[model samples]
Target chain A: MTARRLPSGDFDVEQLTPGVRRPIKLRPWLIFAGVVVVAFFGLIFSRVSLDRSGFELDDLEEQIAIEEARRGDLRVEVARLQDPNRINAIAAEIGLVYPTVRIEIEVPGLDVEGIDPEFRWAQLKAVLTAQP
Target chain B: MVLGVAFVVAWAGIGFRIVRVQGFEADKHAERGEQQRVRTEALTAPRGTIYDRDGVELAVSIDAVTVTANPSHMEDPAAAARLLAPLVGVPKSVLKERFTKPDSQFAYIARRLESAQAQEIRDMVEETEMAGVYFTSEPKRIYPAGDLASQVIGFVRDDDMAGLEGLEWKYDEALAGTPGQQIVERDPYGNPIPQGEFVVDPAQPGADIILTIDREISSAAQQILAQAVKDYNALAGTVLVMDILTGEVLAMVNAPTFDPNDRSDANPEAYRNRAVTDVYEPGSTLKVVTLAAALEEGVVTPSSILKVPGTLEVGDKEYTDVGRTKAKKMSVAEIVAKSSNVGTILIQDLLGNEKHYEYLSAFGLGQVASGDLPGEASGRLENVRDWCDTTCGPSTAIGYRVDVTPLQMASVFSAIANDGVLVEPHVVREVISADGTRQRYEPTERPVVSEETARVMRVLLQGVVESGTGSRALVDLYTVGGKTGTTEKFVPGEGYSEEDRIASFIGIAPIDEPRIVVAIVLDSPSGETEDGSDMRFGGVSAAPVFAAIAEAALHRLGVPPNVR
Candidate 1:
C-alpha cells in the first residue's frame, strides 16, 4: 500500500497487488428482492393462464355434451323416417300399388354366323346400332 | 418473576399445539380438506340398439330428461306445479299433492320427457327462479316400428328400462352396459380445480343385437293377420313365417297386438307371442306326421292302397270322418288328401305305440323350439308309458290327444321343406359389441327322416294343395304344398268346445325348391262369412292367409315366379 499527496494536500491510497484487480461491491439483499419480485409476477401470470385454460376446458366439455344430444336427436329422427308403415302409407299416397303378378323373362340362346370380312363388318355395325 | 413464569407457560402451550397439528392431526385434516373438494360422479353408458336382419332399427335407446325435485326446498308448491303441469304432462293436482309434502327429500316430477319438452320446462323453471329443481339424463326405450313385431320385440319397464318380456327379457344382460365413475377435485362453488388429483374409470357400453326377422315380411304378415282376424271376426290370429333352409324365423306375428310404445293401453294377453307361447291341437295337420312316419317305416308308399271306412273303432271310442257315409278303398295319398280320420288311425295302428312315441319325440314334440325367446310352452305330448288308460293312438292320429304350438307345427312342415332336416327355430342372428366384436348364433339341426321319405311326403303334400283339401291355398305362377287343420278348442272343465274351432294351415311355397314355410292359425273364427259363405274349414279360412303372406314374402325375397 502507498499514499500520495496532491497540491491541495489531499492524500490518495492505492493497492499494489500482483495483477490488475477491481474492488466490486455487491448488495445481496437487493438482488434477492429483484428475483423475488420477478418470481411473484411469473406466478400470477401462470395462475391467470391456468384459470383461463380451465374455463376453456369447461366450454369444450359443454360443447361435446351439446353435440352428443344433437346426435341423439338425429338418430331418433332417422329411426322415425325409416318406419315401414310410414313407407307403406307414403307409397299408397303416391298412388302406387303392390304388384299382383311377378314375371321373369328368359333369354334366348345366340347362334354365331360365319366370320368373313363382310360378316364381321355387319356385326360391328349391328353393335354400333345397338349402343343407343 | 411471577409474570415471567406465566409468559413461559403461555409459550409452552403454543409450542405443544404446533407439534400436535404438525404430527398426529395432519393426516386427518388433509383427508377432511380433500373430502370437501373431491366428488365422485357417475358416468352412464348407453344401451345397445336392436336391428333386423337387413339392418333396420327395430328398437333403440334414446336420451331423455328426468325431472326431479327436493320437495322440502320448494318455495311455492302450487306455483311450481302450475308451471310444470302441462310441460311434464302430469295433472296439476297430482303435482301439487306431491310437491306439498314438506318432509319429502326428493320426488319425481316427470320421467322420460321429450327433449323439447324438457328444455321448455327447464327454461320456465329458471325464469321463475325456482330452487331445488333438477334434471337428469335418462335412457328411454323406443320401438319405432310400433306394433309391427311388438310381441317379438316386447317392451321394457319405464323405471330402469329393464326388459319385461320376449327377446328383451331373454337377452337383458347382453343389452345393458356397465356404468362407470369419475372422481375429481372441485372448488368451494363446485368448479373443478386445476392441477388437482383427478381420476376416471370410463364406462363400458353395451352390445348391439341383430335379429333374424325380416322387417318387411313381418309387417306384411302382421297386417294380413290383423285383417284376417277382423274379416273373420275371430278372437285372435297368429302367423309364423320362416326360412326352411336356416330355420330363421322371418316373421312371427299375432293379431290383437298392442303398441309397446304406449304400453298403458296394451293388454297383458296380447303380450304373449302366440306362435311360441300358446298351444293348440293341430287337427289334420298332424296327419302328415302320421303318414310321414308310416312312409319312413317303409310300411306305405304314396300309391299304397288302404281300406278306409267312414268310421273306425279304437278301445271304447269311435272316430268318424267328417262327411263320409260308407267304406271306401283309397290310396294313401288320396286318404291324406281327403284328411280321412279312419286312414290316419289305421296308419297310427300300424305305427304302433313304441314307434309312434319314438317318432313324435324325434319330430321335436314334447320340447321347446330353443332360441332367444322366453316363455315357450313345449305343449302336451304324453309319453307312451303314461298312455295306457287313454285312447292315445287313434286320437293322436287325428291330432286330438296331442297339443302343439304353432311354431312346432311350422317347424314340422319346415322339416319336410328342408328335406327332413329339422333345424332349431331362432330369432337372434348375431350379437355385436361396442368394440366391433361379433358373437353369431349357429342353429342346431337334426335329421328327422330320410330325404327319400321327405320327397315322397312333399309329393303327398302337393296333392293336398293341388287337388285336395287345401286346393284353395294354391298360388299363381308357383307350385304349392300344404296341409289344413281344423281342431276344436279344448276347454279345461269340459272335453272340447263345439262352437270354438281353431283353423290353421301350414304351407311350403315353390314346392320344387321349397324356400319358405308359413303357418297360420285363427282362433274361434266365424263359421260363416257376412254373406253366408262358409269360413269354418282351415282350407277355406287359414289357407288364403297363407297364400297372401307367402306371395308377399316370396316376392320380397326376389324368388322368380316359374308359372306352371
Candidate 2:
C-alpha cells in the first residue's frame, strides 16, 4: 500500500501492534443513528394520520348510504298519498267535495285545512324548523 | 467417471427446464391470480322521464337503496332475520324460513326504503356491526304532478313497474330503454376490486317521451265535467277535449282515476279509457247523424218544411212526441232544435237506410278510432241489416242499438267543427331512441263530408245549442254548437228500467272559428221525480257538463276573447 501524508505530516508503516490499542471513531455511526431516529418518528405520525382519515371517509360513506335509502322511501310515500280513489274515499268519508278536475283529492275538513289561521301559522313554524 | 459426467449433464438440463417453465408461466399465473381478486359492478338502467307538452316535468326516477343478503353467509340466520324483519316489512318467521336452508343464496332483506328509514337503519348499522349485509343502488319512479291527466297517461304495472295503460302502454318500448350489460369478474368472496384498466360498459338510459297532451286544457275540461257530474247527480262521467284544427286531443279524463305512482287504491275499471273503450247508444246525438245523411244526400234542405204531429204511427207501433205537444209546421232546422222524432224519421225514409249507413261511416261510426290502444272496441253497429224489423230503421234513425264511445262521437263532431275534415286523434308525438334520436308522428287527415254539408250541419247544431234541448250547454263567452243524447237503458228481462238512462252531450266551441270539441256521457242516473219524470234529457244532465268543460277549456287554452 502507498502511504499518504496527513495534515499531521505523519504516515503509519505498521497497521497496529497487537498490544497497542486506539479508541474507535464515533462520527459516522452517530450521524446514521440520528437519521434513523428521525425517520422512525415521521413514520409514527404518518400512520396516525392515515388511520384517522380512513375513519372519516368511512363515516361519510355510511351517511351517503342512509340518504340513498331515504330517497327510495319518499317515492313510495308520494305514490301512496296522491292516490285518487284513496283520496276521494277519504273525502267522501269526511264529506269534502272538489271541483271537476280529475286528479283532485279531498280529505276531511278540507276547507279548514285550507283556511285555518292557526294551522297556517303552524305550517309556517314547521317550515322554519324544517319539520314540514 | 462416466456416471459422474452423465449426472453433471442431466443437472444442467434440469436447471434449464426449471427456468423455462417458471419464466414463461409467470404472466399467465399472475393474470389468473388477479382474476380471483377482481370485483364486478352491477349497473341497472335508469328509468325514463315524463314531461308535459310545455316542457314541464311530470314524473321522474330517483336514486334509492335496497338491502339484500346471502342467507348462507349469516352465522345466526334466525338472529339476522329478526333484525331485518322490521326494515323489510316482513315477518321474522318468514325470513327465518327463507334462511333455514342456508343454501338459498340471496334473500331480499329489505326493499326500497325512505330517507328516514334508511338513515335510522344506517345509524343502527354503524352503532351495531351488521356484517354480511349488502346494499345496492336502486331506482323508484315518482310522479311529480300526481293524478293529473291520469286517465290518459294511464298507470304502470306493480310487478315490473311497466306502463300497462294509456300513453304509458302506447309508447312503452320507447320509454323503456334497452337495458345494457356490464360483465364483471368477481372474487370468490364476492368482494369487488376495481380493475382500473379493464373494459367497462355503461348502461343506455331510456329516451324522454313527449305526449301531445296539454295539461292545462285537460284540467280545465275535467273541472267543468266534475261540476256537471255533481249538479246532475249522474253516476260517472267522462270529458274529452280535442283541437278541431289538428285532431290532437288536448285532454281526455275519466272519473274514478288512479295515481300511477300508487296503484293500491285503484280499481281495475279506473284503468279503462272510457273515451274510446266505453260505448253507449248515443240517443239524440245519433239523430244528428241521420239529419246529416239526409242533408248530404239532398233528401232535405235546412228550410224544408215538415208537418209535425204529437205521435207518428209506423207498422202498429206508435212513437210519441217528447212533450206531447200538438202538430205544427216547422222547418228542418226547427225539427233539430225541437228534436222531433218524426222530422228525423221522415228524412231517414227519404235518404234510405243505405244512405244513412254511408253517412254514419263517414262520421267515424261502426269502427274504432284505431288509436294507440291495442284493444279498442268497434262499438256495436250491426250493419243496418240487423235492424229489428219493426223498430229497426226508425229506432236507429232516432239513435238506438248503435253504441258509440265518447271519443268516436267527439271525432264526428270534430269533423263538423273542422269543416268536414276528419283528423285522427293522436297522443304520442314522437318515439325517441336512447341517444336522443327521434322519429316523429304527423297528424293524419281524411275528408268525410263536403264543406257545404258540414256548414249546413254546423248551423243546425248551433241552433240546437242556442235554443233547443242543448241550451244547457251554452257558454257565456262563446257561441257553442252541440247535440244531446238521453236514452233509456234496456234491461234484459225488464225491458227498460224506470231509472236506468244514459244522458250524453257533445259540443263544439267558438262556432265562428271552431276550436275544441268536447263530449260527456253519464250512465244510470239515480234521482227521478214525477213532475220531471222524463227529465232525463241530455240538456238537464250532459249538456251542462259540456258547457262547463267548454268554458274551462277555452280559458285554459288562453283563447282570446274574440268569440262572437
Candidate 3:
C-alpha cells in the first residue's frame, strides 16, 4: 500500500478511510429550514389538488339536482292526468252528458208580421182578376 | 490515478443512458398518462312521448332520481344494506355483494323513485354514513292516465326506459333523442374537474309526438269496455272507439290491463296489445264488405230479394243461417236483420270472389296498420291472387277462412258509419319536447265508398239494431246501427271447438247522424252473468259496453242527443 499525505500532514490511511469521518460541519437550523421548505411545497400541492376535485364534485351534484327536479315535474303531470275531475272535464268536452241532452233549438225572428187576411179574404173573395 | 480514470468512464456511461431513456421513450410514457385519465361516460337519450289525438298527455318521460353507490367507498356495506332494505325492498345480501367488489365502482341501488320516496331514501343514505353512496338522475316513463287506452299507449322496460310495446314502441325513434357524453378528470379525492375542457357535445332532447285521440271519447270507451268485460266474466275483453268522419282512433281499451308504472312479472302475452295484435274470426260482421261490393257493382240493389235457406252447401262444407228457413225470400234489409248465412253467400257470389276480396283489401285488411307498434298484424287474408280452388272462394265470406283485429273491425265499421270516408287509425296527437317545441298528428280522410251507398247501408244496419241479434244494443235516446258476430273459436288439433266461442259486436249510435263506431270482443265467456260486464252473446256481452262509452263520450264531446 502506498502512503497518502493528508491536508493536516497526517500519513495515516485509517483516519482518511472511507465511511469513517464526515469532516463538513452541518448547522441544525439550516437543516430545519430545508425540511420546512419541502414540507410546505408538498402541502400546497396536496391542497390545490383537493380544491380542484371538490369543485368538480360540486358541479356534478348540481347537474344531478337539476335532472332530479325535472323528473319530479313529470311525475306531477302524470298525477294530474289521473285525476277523476280532470278526466270528467275532458269527457264533458266530447259530448258525454250525465243527463244526456236530446237536443236544443233556437229560432230567431219568429215574431214577423203576417197577414191575418185568411178570415177577411175568404168572404170577400179577395182581389178581382187584374186587367191586362 | 487508475481508479480515478475508471470512475470517470462509469460516470460518462450513466449520463449517456439517462439521456437515451428520456429522449427515446418520451411519447410512450405520455400515452400511458392519457390512457389512465380518459374515460367515456354513458349518455342517456330520452325516449319519446305518446299523446292523445286532442293533445292530451298519454305517455311521457320524466327525469327521476335513482339511488346509486360506489362500492369501493362503502364503509360498512352490510350495515348500510340492512338500513336501506325496508324502504327499497332490496335484499341486504344483494347490496352487500355489490359494495364488497373493489372493481365495481358504480352500482344501481334503487330505481326511478317517487319524489317523497326519493327524499326519504336520500335521508337514509345520509344517515348510513357510507362513503360511496350517491344518487343518479335517469329518465322514467310516465303514463298520465291510469289504465286509459293502455293497450294503445303501451309500456317500457327497466334497465333502460326503452319502449317495450304500443305507440311508445312505434314512435320510439322519433321520441328517443341523441345522447351526449362528458368525460371527467378527477384526483384521488374522486372529484371531477370544473373546467376540464368539458369535451361537451350537447345532447338533443327527444321530439314531441301528438296523437289524434280525443280524451273525452277515450274515457267513455274505457268505461263501457270495463263494465262489459266484468259482466261477461270472460277471459279478456276490449272496446275500440273511432271517429267515422276521420279515421282517427278516439279510444282504444283492453280490460284487466297491467299498469305501466309497475310492470314487472307481467305475462308476456298480457302485454300483447289485443286491439292490433290479436286476430280472430270476425263472424258475420264481414257481410257488409261483401254486400257493398255486390251493390256497388250494380249486381244487386236494396230492393233485390234473395231466397234464403236454413243451411246452404257451397262445397262439402255446409253453412247454416241464424235458423232462417231455406228458400225464404226477403229484401236486402231483411237479409241483414236476419243475418242469413245463405244471403251473404249469394251476395258474395254476385260480388264474385275477386270483387269481394277487393272490397276487403280496400278496407285495410291483410296489411299491417302503419301505427306506432311494430307487431301489428295485417289480420288474415289468403291474398286473393294466391287463393286456391275449392270452397275457399265463398268460404272467405261471412268472416270465415279469414281473420281480423278488433282495431281493423273498428276502422272498417267506422267507414260505413262516417259517410263512406275511411280514416287511418292513429293514437298519438302531438309531441312536445322539454323546451316546449311541439308536433301534432293530424287526421287523414279516405273515401272508400260512395255517400249514397253508405247512406243506404246505414238504413240496413239500423234494421240489425232494431230487429236482429243486436237488439240488445239500442241506446235509450238514439237509434243504433250494429252487427253481431259469433264465430267458432279455432282450436289446434280439432280445427273448430264447438264449446268455445268468441262473441263480438260493432255499433254506431244515432243512425240518422253517425258519429262514433265501436267494436267489442269477449274471448270465450263462461255463459255466466256473475259479473257486471259480460253477457256472452255479442249484444248481451258487448253492446252494453258501447252504450256506456257512447253515453260518457257523447256527453264529454258535447254531442247532442237527436231530438227537437
Candidate 4:
C-alpha cells in the first residue's frame, strides 16, 4: 500500500486493498422480551389442561357415587324378595302346602352303601343314558 | 431542611412497617387464609352384614336419610308441622312444639328414615317452597326375615347403630369398623376447589359374619313354638335345634318374639333368649345323667334290677314317682322309661355324690355350655363340698336342688347324640374380614363317656320315646328318643306354685344315626289337651312340639327316613 500528499498540507494515503464489513450485534432487552412472552403462554396452557382434568374427575366421582347408591338399593330389594314369611304367605295364597309324606323311589343298580347321594345319582344317570 | 427531614422520617416509618408485616407475620396471615378454604371431614365406615348358613341376609345395613330442621328459618311453623306430620309419622302437635321453640336453631325432625320416604319428603318440601328442612344420609340396620330369629340375632340402637342385644352385642367390636378422615379445600358455596389441597384416608369396612342358623328350620321351629305357646295357654316358650355332629345350632326360637324392624311397642321381656338365659329344675329329664353316671362307673347295667318303694323320705323332703304307689322291682331301662323318681334316687345311692358331680361337670353343667351366646347362664350346680349329704344327693338325683338352662339340657342330649363327645355349641359359623380373610369357628370337644356306653344310654333313652313318658315325641318314619321334664314353677321371693309348671323335652332324631338334638321348653302351660291329657306335663305339651320341630328340621336337612 502507498500514500500521496494533498494540496491542503495534510498527509494523503492511497488504499491498495478493498474495504471489509463488520457483523451486526443483537439487543439484550429484545431477547429478554421474547422469552417472557413464550413463558406466559406456556403457563396459561398448562393451567387450562389442569382445570379440565379436575372437572372430568369431579364428574366421574359423582357418577360412581350414584351407581353405588343404585347398587345398594338393588341389594336391599333382593334381600326383601327372599324373605321367608313373604314366600310362605305367597305359597299359601297359591294353595301350596307341605306334603304330609315324602316318598323315596329306589332305582335298580344304584343301591350302593356308603356312597354319596350325588355320586349315586350320577351313576344312575349314566346307566339310564347307556340303556338309551 | 426541616421539610426534607420530615419526608425522610415518614418514608423510614413506612419501610419499617412493610418489613414487619412481610417478614414476621407472613406465616400467620397465610394460615388464616387457608383456614377459610380448607376443611376436614369425617368419613363413616359401613357396618357389617349378618348372613345365615345359606348366605341369606338376616340383618343388614343400608344407607338411610335423617331429616333435620333449623327452626329459626321457618316462616310458618304450624303449616310446616302440618305438612311434615304424616310424612315423618310424628304428631303435628309434637312437631309444632319443636318448631316453635324459642331461639332454637336445630331440631331433629326424624332419624333414619328409609330412602324412599326421605325422597318423598324432599319432593314435598321442594314443591311447597318450604325452608329450614335438610336431609343427611346415614346407616340404618334392618332385619329382612322379620321375626324369624329376632331373639338370636338381636337388634341395634336406632341412633348410632350400636348393638344392644343378642349376637349383635357379642360381636359388636368386629362388626363396627374404623372410621377415616379427609382434608379438602372448598369454595364459599361448599364446592370442591380444583387444583387445591386434597388428602384422604379411606375408611375400612367392618368384617362380615356368617351364622350357623338355618332360616327354614328356624322359621319352622318359631311357628311350632308359637302355636304350642298359644295352644297350651302358656306364658312363653323356647325351642332349640342343633346339629350334634358339627355343634352348629340350626334353630333357636323364642315365642312372643318382637320384630326388630319396628320395636316401638315391643315387650322387653320377650327380648331375652330364654334357651340360653333362663334356668329351671330339669325334672325327670336329668334322670339320664344319674343313669349315665351309674352306667359309666360300672355301678349298674341296663338290665340291673332295683327294688323301688312308693316314696322315699330324706332330709324332711319326700320323693315319689309319678303314677306309682306300690313298691316294685324295675330294671334300669324300665326306670328311665317310667321316669320313676324313686328308682332314680336309688340309682343315685349307688353312684355317690363325688361320682355324680363328676359326670354332671363332664356333661357341661355348672358352666356356660357355649360362649357364642350373650348372657348364657352357667346353670346352678352346687359344689360337692356344699352338698348336704342327706337330701342334696337324693334331691339332685330326682331332678331337684339343681338348675339348668334349656341349652345346657340340649347340650347334654347332644353329647349322647354325638357319641359321648361334648362338643362346644356355637352360633357363629365364620367371620370374613373386609379384605376377604376368613376366621372359622372351631368347636372344642371333650369325651364324656365311652362310645359303647353312649350307645347303651341312647338305647335306654329310645325305650322312653317308644313306649315311655316321651312317647308323644315320636316322629313318623323316623325313630327318635328323648326324656320328659316337668318342674314345679319356682318364683323368686315366693315358694313353688302348684298351679304353674315348666314342661320341657329334649330329643334326638334317627337314633341309629343321630343328626340333630331338639330341645323344647314351655313356661307356665295350663289347660289340658283335647284328649284330657294334662298340659302341664312335658309329655303332653313339650314332647309334641319336639316332634313337630324334629320332623320339619329332619326333612329340611334331607335326612332320608331310616325307619320303615
Best by DockQ: 4
Encode model 3's per-residue lDDT on A1-132: one tens digit a residue: 798865775567776677886566678878989899988998888878777777767877776776667555755576565655476777789987665453332322234466455644543343322211
Task: Please name the candidate that would achieve the greatest lDDT relative to the true structure.
Answer: 4
- iRMSD for every model: 2.2, 5.9, 3.7, 2.2
For model 3, how many clashes? 47
Cα miss at B407, model 3 (Å)? Answer: 2.3
TM-scores, chain B, all models: 0.89, 0.84, 0.85, 0.91
Runs with alpha carbons beyond 4 Å of true place in candidate 1? A1-34, A99-132, B1-33, B69-85, B91-107, B121-133, B186-197, B530-533
lDDT, residue B392, candidate 1 = 82
Clashing pairs in 4: none
Sliding window of 10 residues with minimal summed lDDT for model 2 chain B:
B190-199
User: In terms of lDDT, which candidate is stronger, 1 or 4?
Assistant: 4
lDDT of 4 by residue, B97-124 (tens): 9999999988999987776677789899
All candidates: DockQ: 0.34, 0.13, 0.15, 0.36
TM-scores of all candidate predictions against the true structure: 0.85, 0.72, 0.76, 0.86
What is the lDDT, from 0 to 100, of the residue B416 in candidate 3? 86
Tens digits of per-residue lDDT for model 3 on B1-564? Answer: 999989998998998877776678768876775556655676787666565655456676766778888777877777877877787888988987877776888888888875567778777777755577777677777777766766677777766766678766776666778887867665455555544434766677777777776665766666666666666667887777776776667777777676676666556566667888889988888888777777777878888987776777766888887555557888888878777777888787777778878888887877765465557888888888887565777677788888888888888888888877778776655667757876665656677788888888888888998898787777766777888887888876888876777888888867789888878888876565544533556766776666666666666667777733
Compose the digit string of candidate 1's lDDT tens values, residues B256-365. 89998898878899999999899999999998788888999987888888888878767789888877969999899988888888988888888887888887888898
List candidate 2 stretches off by more than 4 Å: A1-132, B1-44, B70-106, B114-120, B127-129, B188-191, B196-198, B223-233, B384-390, B490-498, B528-535, B562-564
Query: What order do you get sorting by lDDT, best first?
Result: 4, 1, 2, 3
Q: State the C-alpha RMSD over the true interface residues for candidate 2, after superposing those residues.
A: 5.9
